[model samples]
Target chain A: MDGDTRETIREVAIDLFSTRGFDQTSLREIAERVGLTKASLYYHYPSKQALLTAIVSPLLDGWRAVTDEAEGMAHTPDNVRHVLTTLLDVMVVNRPLASVLLRDPAGVVAAAGPLWQDMIDVATRLTNWVAGPEPTVAQRLRAIAAMEVLRAAYSSITYLREEVADAEMREVLLDSALGALRR
Target chain B: MDGDTRETIREVAIDLFSTRGFDQTSLREIAERVGLTKASLYYHYPSKQALLTAIVSPLLDGWRAVTDEAEGMAHTPDNVRHVLTTLLDVMVVNRPLASVLLRDPAGVVAAAGPLWQDMIDVATRLTNWVAGPEPTVAQRLRAIAAMEVLRAAYSSITYLREEVADAEMREVLLDSALGALRR
Candidate 1:
């Protein structure tokens, strides 16, 4: 029951955050929606930022895991495709969270401060791994381009203001990233 | 003489902002570097943000011009390549200003405010032009990817923490954006 309550609170918070914008939504509203008293909500998650951290952590963990795994693999054409596909999946699956982040970059970036930096560091490593060993300037630049290409998976949601199917995002983004890689 | 002093202040401010970061660099330091009192600097450009705006306006103008020009041309492979090359030149030529913006996106975006939104609007038009008439979701996604790829022209300065020759930036970013466009 306690686990279920926590999960319910998370789902409610994400829905509120996505629909209402992070800053506009308050803890009282979230607690009201979750059918929890403000105190109960506080027991589960102390602050709005704590809830946001909870929401964004998995996406960060997904990237870090993908980077770690890719670092262990060979930098071949097949492996690059596989890694990019996984990264896209992680991003697409987390689209709700990403929408919240993208909608208010200033507030979210400030709140997520260190988490944002961690993501950057993870991205740098992933880009390096994608560049392969002893990359020339062109190769390094291509790697950066390919990574940026993958961002469309989520940014398209905001820009298009509509749902692009996850399958379509995976197919289009994966191919586009590989194209940028010149593979 | 007034115009030269204003230009000199912009140059010194870019240098300091690029090295010490936008948030860390002070208007007084910029004045000192340019051999102006803060009062003199204010006469030319009222505030730190005004100085940044002066430095960044040309880059934004260049983008708006490219988008304006490209909108008039029919989207063809040759035109696409030509437009991409022109965009790369704008980014590469304004890299010093871009480096400051990229180094501190939160600060810059907040400061840029409406100008940043204008850039996004201009970028949307440029991407739409690149996508052409009756674009599919795939084409639209590809256009977004290509624009992101072009960001490497300036982002590389911060990411690599070194100068990538303008020639190399233009060559690699153009080809990479074209590749993402699948042209």
Candidate 2:
């Protein structure tokens, strides 16, 4: 029951923060929507920032897991594709949270320092993997290029939601990213 | 003198909107900063939204210019680089306005419909340019992937400001973007 309430609060907060800008949302509104009294909500999360922290925790964990899996794989073209595809899958699946992170990352970084750092750490590792050993300046640039491409596609939900089918978009983006690395 | 006030108002408003956000800025504040009375400001831009429209006008012009230039070019790899490089130059030179456009595009779009349409038209032209006539599924996907990559890098002042020299980031990003488009 305790866990259920906590999860409920987290889910509601994610929806609110994703749709309305984070700064615009309030604790009372979150509690009201969750069907919990203010006192009960406070028991789960002492403040709105705390609730946001709880909400974004899973996303960070998922990113860590994907990067870890990628790190363990061979750095071949096939392995690179797998890693890129998994990253895209995680991105598309968590579209709302991903959108929030990409659109207003500064606010999220301010509120949750460690999580943001972890995300950058993961990005650096992925870049290293793409560059491999003895990377040229150009290769480093490509890695940055590849990251932006994937991030933009996933972050712009309005664009993706309208034009590309989810599965197909993932495949194409991943393949194109891998293709860039090949040359 | 009349044209100068309009330009000054537009510039001040963009700076305020970029730093303090759209909701936090007021027409009076902009007028004061520009050493004009609120009435004078009103004579130039009747509302905050109109001020925003004026700020975004050049961006829309640049977007249209890039697309128009690309349409005239042959759909070859070198032409792709030239068109994209020119587009990146415009974006980098107008970094603050570009940032505002990326951050709260919906607000800008709502206030200025033509501005939003211009962006979409450019993006469509970009995709078409990369894909060319009789494009395969993979080619279409590649175009979107390339576009996203460039958008992400150019839009991110935080990353671009740090990663490359201010004068040279545009050139570097353009090279990287064109590289992504190459087969």
Candidate 3:
């Protein structure tokens, strides 16, 4: 139950989950990899779903925080740019977790219902805020598209396969998102 | 079955699947709604999966056609715009089917593995062609983002709840996608 062991277990679970898939990877295998008995592993994670929740919660928390901040800010061009930049930073840091969670989006939704719902709700809020008050239909569509452009941060890992630098991804995607929302 | 009955069945199935979900809808329910016995329905579709495949094949075929056509065209800006517009049209026509298929993407992938993989491969080819020959990492990333923007054609149904007209969805999403790809 020490911090190091907990972190090690989490690291091992992410590796297994990403390579082997969330459903395909078993808690038994995770325990074996971490040299812990099944009972001891359960003591930490409780269940496979719990382990997944632990793995992806950071990304969810980051997105929620972004939405909360956006709610308070004026929907000015500069503020929109700042919000997008921070959101991209969150995605960049959580790219590994995104790989696990978004690899099969519906599967993640089914496996972790509340967590996935929270992420969806956060995205909807962020999209609404970006759309601004009394936004035109076109403005709302641009906001949705802009949010989707930011998703390229993680999708680059799948499509380009580590060929693009993280900084380049941040820059290109941020600019592209702004361009998507351009007046 | 006659062509009219067959088409009617497909329409009814799409309605049920979109509202109730692909996994939640059963062949028996579709049969009941279509006023046919289960045996009669089975005679046509063979399984719920077959019905889904029948429902979504048009969209998949449209996408595959776009990819195939793009394969021959030079990756000029004019061609890119044409391709995006054509892709948007395909999505617009298939918005209802897109709702059924994309509502639970992983579930559809599981239910129709080969069809889903074929769609993914077609998407990759389209992305590559859109990226152009000997593309830079940044160019490839933009191609991916642009493709994601085009996805809003269907996602608009989920988010905007049919408030955005098909014409508006086509116009705005095409513009946003091009903007995402703009250098």
Candidate 4:
């Protein structure tokens, strides 16, 4: 019920879910990690689905902000670079949550159908920013590839356990993402 | 099981699994699609996991072949081109299986743990070929982004339902993939 307990529960859930996968993890595991009883955890979040819904809600809001801001920006290479950088910032700040989300996109889609649809809509808008507001097929493909790089920034095993600090990896990944959209 | 019936079941299962997702799909659903009783379907594949294993096995083999070949070749841009082109061929030949595999990566990882590990190993080998056997950090990142584009060749909703024929999409996707690696 309190902010501290809820935040702690959410963090532990995200850590377990991101590494082991959403299905492989359970509320008990999260509660054990958070040092809470199942009933106590349920008092705050009723279900695993509810916990995930709580985690993703704010992430979706951040993504919405990026996409909405991108809509008013110019569709130039500089714009693409700036957009990808901003997107990567959001993903990195919420790296654990992003990993949990990306870890099992299809499972998430099945479990949270309406939420997944919202994600797809946000993705569509984000890709438009990367590919340009009006993109050719090649540009569209490039945009998607660049987006994958941003997804990889947090989601992939490489980035998740990178020897480099998150700050350095962010710059490196941003460069790679911009390079992907270069063509 | 007869070859015809087994192949038909596999095809229908792949179609359903790829579109709907592996976990969400039930054995009964697959059997219904194939006009078979659950008992009859169980006679071939004891479980949905077995069906997926049967489907992904050949794909794993194909990937193995690509990685093996790339291992022998020089790490030139031309070789990277050849490897990606060949990878695309394998993907196109087994688009449905690729889609199924990509659609629910985490579910597949959970249900088919060792098999998925083998896939990650193969992917690592393949990326080495594309990024050069001894790659720098940037090369490694580019290799991954390029691989993501190849993944897009089949797994993405856009390419999966392109108004363009599979052949045309293949070419378009191939170009996009090569472009990703052009550091």
Per-residue C-alpha lDDT of model 2 across residues A45-126, encoded as one tens digit per residue? 8877787777777777777888888778877877877777888887878877765664444456556668678777776776
- Of the candidates numbered 1 and 3, which has the greater DockQ value? 3
Q: List CA RMSD, all candidates.
A: 5.0, 4.7, 3.8, 2.8
| CAPRI quality level assigned to candidate 3 from its DockQ score | acceptable
Assess every candidate by TM-score. 0.76, 0.73, 0.82, 0.89
Interface RMSD of each: 4.3, 3.8, 2.8, 3.2
lDDT of each: 0.80, 0.69, 0.82, 0.76
Range of the 10 consecutive residues with the lowest summed lDDT in candidate 1 chain A = A101-110
By the TM-score metric, which is better: model 3 or model 4? 4
lDDT of 4 by residue, B13-70 (tens): 8898888778768888988989998889978877777888999999999999999998
Per-residue alpha-carbon lDDT of candidate 3 for residues A111-161, written as tens digits (9 for 90 to 100)? 797888888788888888999998899989988999888877766665676
- Expressed as tens digits, the lDDT of each residue in A103-161 for candidate 1 is 45445655677988897799889999999999888899899889888877765754665
Q: Each model's number of backbone clashes?
A: 0, 0, 0, 0
TM-score of chain B of each: 0.85, 0.82, 0.90, 0.89
Which candidate model has the greater TM-score, 2 or 4? Answer: 4
Best by TM-score: 4
Quality of model 3 by C-alpha lDDT: 0.82
Consecutive 10-residue window with the lowest summed lDDT within model 2 chain A: A153-162
Q: Give the TM-score of candidate 2.
A: 0.73
Going through the candidates in order, the fraction of native interface contacts each one reproduces equals 0.43, 0.26, 0.50, 0.28
Model 4 residue runs over 4 Å out of place are A1-3, A155-162, B1-3, B158-162
